[model samples]
Target: MTAEKRIPLHILREITNGFSEHSRIGRGGYGDVYKGVYSGREIAVKLLHVDTVLGHDDRQYINEVGNLLKVKHPNIVQLLGYCYEIQNELIEHNGANRFTRHVYRVLCFEYLQGGSLDKHLREESFAPDWSTRYKIIKGICEGLNFLHSCEPPIFHLDLKPANILLDSSMAPRLADFGLSRLFGGSHTHVTNRVVGTEAYMPPEFIKDAYISHKNDVFSLGLVMIEIIKGSSGYSGYIETDEVGQFTQKVLGNWKNRIKATSEYPLEESHQVQICIDTAMRCVEPDRNNRPNIAEVLDILSKTETHIPKRQMADVFPCPTIGLKSESNMLEIMVAELNNNEHIHCNLMPTDNSNRTVQQLADRETSSDVEQVIIGRTKEKQKILSILSESITEEMVNLPIYGIGGIGKTTLAQLVFNDPKFQDYTRVWVYVSQEFNLNKIGNSIVTQLTDKISNIPTK
Candidate 1:
């Protein structure tokens, strides 16, 4: 994260084509969001409407920025820059021309390519795999947990699918903090100025104007349900008196999907069950009965205990033949062990054992092969960031795993050939399902010997 800088409004207008309608990405109660480029990187710009009266929107902007500045978490959206500029223009008021003061309030965030989770949940045809959904649910929980862990605890009063943005890799980041509040002693507050999506609001927040960490918990439960059972899940839950039966039905729906798609159907099925159970517990009408975010995450962590300890997968791209042939053979991942990153990454283990590769990134690789590789720059940069941060003296093996035909090999190749690795003796050995640590070690030794043998005797 970088320090929040004040950006000029003119620069934003230019980047967004004078805030054209086509550039607008979303609208909210306080303002409009637009896609814009800043400092050569894609960014999201929020243009907040100024209300000359009670100045409530101003408080929203301040509240959002203030909380955002205090928090830093991977699952939480990052604030890159902001703009607060005052402009005066001549306007006819009371049948006389006068200069009126107007203030521009803008916020900039790192652009997310996958858009909001609301869109995904609302789309009947769009179903993200169970793994992606589980990851998102867990991410939201962790972020909520982080907010709750803050000193005095920050409550995200507005928590919903619409406020959760997905990145290129489908990771969820919490956004929209206008309604968040910080409560110190007793960890509770009461205010009648209730605002936010009604459906996600808990009984206490909506009925009594009561607020607590559990307020966000209740909302989180609704969000997790929607992520698991579609946008209609919450409605169905509220309608059901037999919560146990409703949960089973939700789990059953996911089980069928897992049967069709997931390799670890049992593990995914277990996750789906936990999510349903957690959601049921989180949305309890009595705030006292609702599980806190930490407790929710505690339960989510148990999901890992049910999953297999290891499921290593190998991926490499082969020459594309035809649609049928390529689908069958282009990606051959052998897995008996499983890791989340291994699920959908295109990375490989390192060959260097004697000296760790300190920097595994950020040099160009424009070979003829890479010229054909499209839509992998973000993946490449992400790997480079991970590599660049590794301890200079230690080895960090990054295994790339992803669904079939997702260009895992292309990303691996991109990172491997980057000029940053020029100093290292490179070795490329394809490992398959029959993963033999001894055999892999021998192969690396043989490659190192061959490279040494080829070196000039001088």
Candidate 2:
């Protein structure tokens, strides 16, 4: 599979407002994430730090993009684009000033409105309920299984709460592939340079740099444990015991959770217990003892699995806020799925046949539509001129009226895609026959800025 299109650095800077502090949403090991808008879509841009761009960092960047190019699954974040541009800058070297050109790497990813899994975790007031938590666990396992099942196998060295993002529907999407490595038909790759979040890294990986599919499985196990227990449990769990002891402690907690409430179905409790047991097996000190991701997933699917009916919580945008409302849950779920087509992604087949992988790869990397834009040179220039003359700082509104089947939407798309207005944040709201002001407002707010806006209410 080929990687995402290489975006221009200038366009990135323009969209991100010069990487301003206001645009900054989160920080990673090598860089900061900024929220940006391009082509009427919200995107997350990871700007790698200049100081942290060492030789190894370059390899890590390349590895991440390459591995992401090879995989496509519902739980994995979509790579929208990337930028690798070099520019000359003056700096002091060895107590003297000098000028040198440095390459800056920036990765663009789909912006998840729900933010990271860590955001709604234990400490947050918006912590997900048991059912939502179960869905998240299943999603993570499925995503990890896909990675492990890859031809060469992709190992996500970091699989902590912070690395897992959630879409608008609270579905988990794995992100942050900077620490990933591709295992080329080898059982393990041993090295002295151990790199990963300490809490999530397996013992073997940390001590011996033993890299393999099990490494990610072990990390996923920790993440699962943290999900069931809170992140606060990490300290006590690590301090009190080894993997075996940890497993026993987790099993004890599972038993308590099962016995605590009669409302919790016995079958569901059994499935939860299986998940905990799978996690325990994954964290085994010996790589040979650890269950592979496939095995873990197989064990997780032991219970009766079925499509979950949407609960009452699915009807409201802020269920955690205790807002009283009565509505049909299934209808709400269907409406939501229709409203946001991106979150409707489904799991791909587990088997890594060349045809399957190739088909998936082709769908993502295809530039056919992009190449067929048929840039109407004269029309584009005229529209650009009109927009330049009409737009003002005081929110000037211009309406372009046309009959159905006319290229009105196409013209707007061309304008939005133009490079001249790359600096401005664009939001496209389709207010069809059912014109709801609140919905349009929320949609525009969500598209332009994520930090200041509350979660959108449909």
Candidate 3:
């Protein structure tokens, strides 16, 4: 462990603005954390509650500083410095001369702007994308692996979303090691007292006070499941079947958003299923059956990873009832196309086999757009006839060439929504001023998998 600096208490007070409530960021068992600016660098200063910390013989403070100094990894939070000092004040008690002493213990850590993972997990309107969430899970695994594979394995008794902080770029960094215990060449330890969150505790740890690396595996498993499902806590209250069945059911519940965002049926993806399999193995009832940190990392790092093809249609899926009008769809389509090369909309079909309309909100209706179109019957019939002619031949390129604001998109939408074309496979490609055949082909493949796009609005 490197030599940590000893910071003065007066400097900590000055930077934290006298530990004002405005500067406070979080509160834990130790004390309140304040955001401080030291030497032009933002830092998190945890001013330990002297009364509370002193009771435990300053064990929590000592453990945190010790662990932080010992471990240094990209995924683990770094310790900047610490302050352990004392202040003496002369006083008169009972009309006699006396002196009082105040001890100060403060730990400084790198400040993360994005706050904790728990904040993002609880957001209903906008959750992290699958790619970001996957990176976080992977990072957590790497951090745990590093700790468990040390010269003397360290057991982080408290590993949860609240303790995981996100940096400015949304990369996760594991923090809060007050509950961590280092084992000396021993794989497991037995203690009468359990000190960790109940939801993340393994059965053996809670029942037998047994502590090992497997305990961390169990916690990691729960965290992975919650992160994927966007649940705030474990779903232990829910009656669960076998691990496979439980995973299938969870994925089935999120199949709609998964399809629209991922552009691939997650249930059918081998890479996704492997994650489920690994999570199940980690959360096994028997610790002996569970995979260790190395095995878990190996399973998660499989090279047979599937990368979804970017599609225009998937980027801007079918126009939704949530949109205010045809103009709204046009605005969103244009904005998404110009702003981003890839987009994930919540409005899409539920599953691969079901193309029926799935409403985005409680007020959304399937016939919302149908009512907005006043007269397109003749236009629809003309497009249908042209499509019929092209279907009969081996291959044909039939384009409805027209000038701007000529109702080309409206005519196409009407024909596509017609009941006759419901059974036939359809692909919607919206080429702008610059046309790219490769992108269009990918869009077609995505549409074949039941992801449909809309006509471009010029």
Candidate 4:
């Protein structure tokens, strides 16, 4: 690891305006982070929580700085400088204020305007299409591979959406090395003190306290699934599905999305399938069953070969430099991927055999609403499927919520007009905040007044 500058606390304060509230940008387990200007460039400064970090021999701070110093990959967040200092400060002790020595530790990084990956995933109003999400996932895998490829490998024990930051281009950079660890020649280590976000922790770490590079794989699987499925956590039922079912279900979700939003649905759907297959394998319950980062990245790279050569630059915007693999090698990898026996190569339908999606399109009623809405196909199908399956003589109300211009109204219209529900009584009621049960009931009664006399209360 190269030596990093030991920035003085005063300089940090100057850049961050004495860590003012307005300058504060984010918070984490270790400390609060602030946006600052250093050497004419914007940077992020993380100030260690004095109580939690100062007394523990400062191992966490040192560990993060050490790991950051060793890495120089584009997908890895760069460490600009660090601050370690001790100063006399005012403190309250035993009902009196006194002066005491305070140890201040901070780390700085290049400012990324797109912020954390979790923010982009959490905002429901705006969703990036398949191409953007796929690149972010692939970038993360590449970063993880670089870490594992280090001579004395580094493992990001705390890998999750929040720990990944993005640039304006939406390319991801892995960050927050407070929980990272470096190992020499050992593949796995057992640590008694297992600490990380529990949702992303591998089962072995929670139960057996065993950690290997596959631990990161487990977290990456969850993160990738969340990315693929738009931050649903993929936590409970999604992870439990058998391989084939899960692949089809997720591929179906993206397939529907790509069909509506892409000029290249065929290639994009194939990419989604590869991602799901890799993600499922990454999350295998047995750590030994999970593929290493290198293997995971190898498969992800094959997506590039499948994409049209002209569109490859747009799909994978942040490809590696100074290295180009043989095109034949990638084709060989694709062949190996096809023969992997476990993978279900359900790409495009060659003929009428694949008319299922086409038939859904065929059945869609051409209504006054189009001009053709761009991205609500999957959601429309989901609502229709739910209504179809769960409409057994009971009132089913599914409330869709989002900010203005997210197509909540357009989706409602699509579902209302769909032929699948022609037999079922369809009542469209747009409710307001000052809602009245009698008013809504009266509207429902009015709609049903002419449509059916029975009202099918049965």
Candidate 5:
């Protein structure tokens, strides 16, 4: 669609009217996914639950669509068209009725009948044979390879089974491009605000560490392990202390088996073992050590020659006792602090040299109560420059936290715009109210690394 031409609201109304219950295929954080017959062809329509031009979510929604439209690839899901409409409807709850305006932002996509990989694995009756699993894994690797091989590698920040869709013949396709990012220059890394599923996320990303294509590889490794085990492999590790240890142990065992023989038993197929090994390599603690998408594809191709059965090996368990204790301790401290409401102290120190600390604290408090007042534009720019310089010297995760209107985002924007930031090839992303973790992750991946956006099916 051209920028000058807009989809009429009447046409959008007609489309929604045609979306019967029978056409509803799935539902997600965005809204409902419907399989619609338009112009005699089937298409998957993702109807957004919110408006793209209203509230704080508008910027994020519009940005996502604009980014998706710019990147075109065979593996990436194509955005055929979009529909926007608003309708006033009455809702009754507990015998009370109210009128509200509902806004819809619907996106149309190519239909894939095989469904999501997550749905298949979660269902007991839909177990895929070892050969089918291998093929799916290979397809994903090829898609990723294509993305990485782009002029500037793309990073798929979120790599998970649920995002992968299958066509009628079980061919895997990458479906979502909402979170993909395109790497534009020589600087290899960019620090992003923490996003994505915690279980599948790399430790660095979780800590707001410098992110790169390696983060995507780490996530892909987690997905690969889950596919091999025929389970949501990392779910059990959630809230556990020994999650890293467990992952290392399982991956090590698989790698040892793969290294020992070429003609392994069907029950212990070398392909499965190698796949696990590659995944482990991707999840290496050091991002520098993880393989690139092209290397991952090569490895997967080499291992795809054989099929392996599922083995009931001893599963490694994450240590949760220590973690639970820490959580309980934090909760107790918070409760105690909250209960002592009467206790107050003058944070300002008696020493004259320490007055700046008190002044800064007072300013912060005032900023929270009202918007930060910048009397001089030049002074504001100067402060931003100083902060950015300080941040650049350290390779650590430092959050730019402050009150909403106290210029946290404004300061970040200045840093992003600085000429120095260009050296690192920065990607400036804003995760406003409409943030979707999966889409954010995908954007980072496609933009930063060489990975195709094609999500394979169930």
Candidate 6:
């Protein structure tokens, strides 16, 4: 099924504005996240960076969304929606005023109040105890196992402490799917461009070696070792044999102590010892020796009884908010803007192959033609951005008008991917010369509803 069209900007402003300062949660390379109430339930909103480059190919975003939509395991992050829109501004280029605006993409998901596992390990005040750490590791393993067990299988290209989020009960959930890949059976190896954070990537991946599910296993092992050592300094090579020797010595002593301690009880001491052993096995230098996700899950399952489960629901109170339909206000605004206008909004039947088009007639005076054209472009972009932030049910359709090769399509693309529009679900289709009304209407309907064929035309 086709994905939903990108949200407009006026809606984005409304969504962001509704998010009070107190609800601001975290910040990252993309943008800031805010805790908000949606439909009387709590949710997390990840605002994408307007200037962030999503690459020329749109498949990256499409792949990530498609992957998330298929997986429904409790350990993985749930994608609620996304936003896309354009923004216009003046930039200084070679001492001249260059008019350009960028398209932004944002995604929304279920909120995890406990923050990331990295935050807990790095912060002294929130450092997880031995028991909590063990449980978190098992939870992550379970998530990886689920991903690896998919029919064609899925691979999380990027796996690190920061990407692992924890719920209110401290249960771990994997987030950030911008770099994930879904594989097919016949495809034994994927040789695409390398994309991921440096430190977390495995040696084979960085060197452009054939990547498989084993690559993710290697990264998971590295994360496991870091958590065990309670050290964030996993980057850079080990300078001296002393560090490795020191670690081995500590494990040896702990093992001997557990064997001798009859008073302390073997069960408690054995749990800690088993965790260390498993971590060592995971970070083996040779990829062939690294355990698969299934084996990791098996090891974790054996120790499950030792770790306690925390109920995430007990931590945060549910918000009592109601969904407000903003369609009327949107219609009114569009009408006012279209007053004495040269564009006509048409309701036509479209299919999954193109966008619904609104034909426009440009009535411009020769003297102020350029000024009028530029001004209208910026206004349209701004309006689209606003619609994205609002997250209303109705589809947002705005057609940019200009002569061929005058950047009309380019401007629409910029508006569709704007970061400010990230909060709503979205998709963009180019309908340049192939404009079938039935196909276009069907495409819009499919995107908004995820159904194929027989879409009702208005």
Best candidate according to lDDT: 4
lDDT of 2 by residue, 227-325 (tens): 876453463134324655765676566556556642445655666667767766776777788887777777766553432222311111111212223
Model 1 per-residue lDDT tens digits across residues 117-205: 98888787756577767778889988888999998688888898889999887789999876787778899998868677888888877
Q: For each candidate, what TM-score against the reference?
A: 0.66, 0.61, 0.60, 0.64, 0.52, 0.56
Score candidate 1 by lDDT.
0.72
lDDT of 3 by residue, 1-458 (tens): 24437678899999999999999998876578899998899999988776522445366557667776778998888888888777776778899987777668888889988899988889885353555666778889999999998767878878889889998767788887767877775678898765888888888988898999899998888888878777686645233456657778766655655677664455324455666677777778789999998888887676223342121111111222342453454455445444434333222322233354332221233334455554444545666676664564133444555545444555556665666665554445666678654445435434443344454543
| Candidate 6: worst-modelled 10 consecutive residues by lDDT | 309-318
- Model 5 lDDT tens row, 1-458: 34532345465446656566776888755567777666666777777666524764445456556655655655566676676566787888689998777776677777877888888777755544455667678778777777666666766666778778887766677766545566678635655445455676787777655567787788788788777666664552232355456556654555554446423444346566577778778878778889988898887665533322222122222232344544454344334334444322112222223111111111222223223323224434555455454453223333544434445554444444444433342333446588544444333333333332322211
Ranking by TM-score: 1, 4, 2, 3, 6, 5
Off by over 4 Å in 5: 1-9, 18-23, 51-63, 70-74, 84-104, 125-128, 186-194, 236-268, 304-458
Error of 2 at 85 (Å): 1.3
Single out the weakest 10-residue window by summed lDDT for candidate 3. Answer: 309-318
Best to worst by lDDT, what's the order? Answer: 4, 1, 3, 2, 6, 5
Clashes of each: 11, 0, 0, 0, 41, 50
In candidate 3, list every pair of residues with a backbone clash.
none
Higher-ranked by lDDT: 1 or 6: 1
> How far off is model 3, as Cα RMSD?
16.0
Pick the winner on TM-score between candidates 1 and 6. Answer: 1
Model 5 weakest 10-residue run by lDDT: 354-363
Predicted structure with the largest TM-score when compared to the true one = 1
- Assess the local accuracy of residue 58 in candidate 6 as a C-alpha lDDT between 0 and 100: 49
Model 6 stretches with alpha carbons more than 4 Å out: 1-9, 18-37, 49-56, 85-102, 125-129, 186-192, 236-265, 304-458
lDDT of each: 0.72, 0.67, 0.68, 0.73, 0.58, 0.61
Q: Give per-residue CA lDDT, model 4, range 1-458, as digits (tens).
A: 23447788899999889999999998887789999988889999999787523654476667668878878998999988898787888878999999887778898888899889888888885355888888799899989999988877888989999999999878899998777887775767898775678889898898998888999999999898888878655574344637678677778888888999887788889888888878888888888899999999889887765353222111111222222333333344345445445333232212223121111221233355545565456567777776666554333456666545455666677877675654444456666778644444434444433321222211
Selected candidate, larger TM-score, 3 vs 6: 3
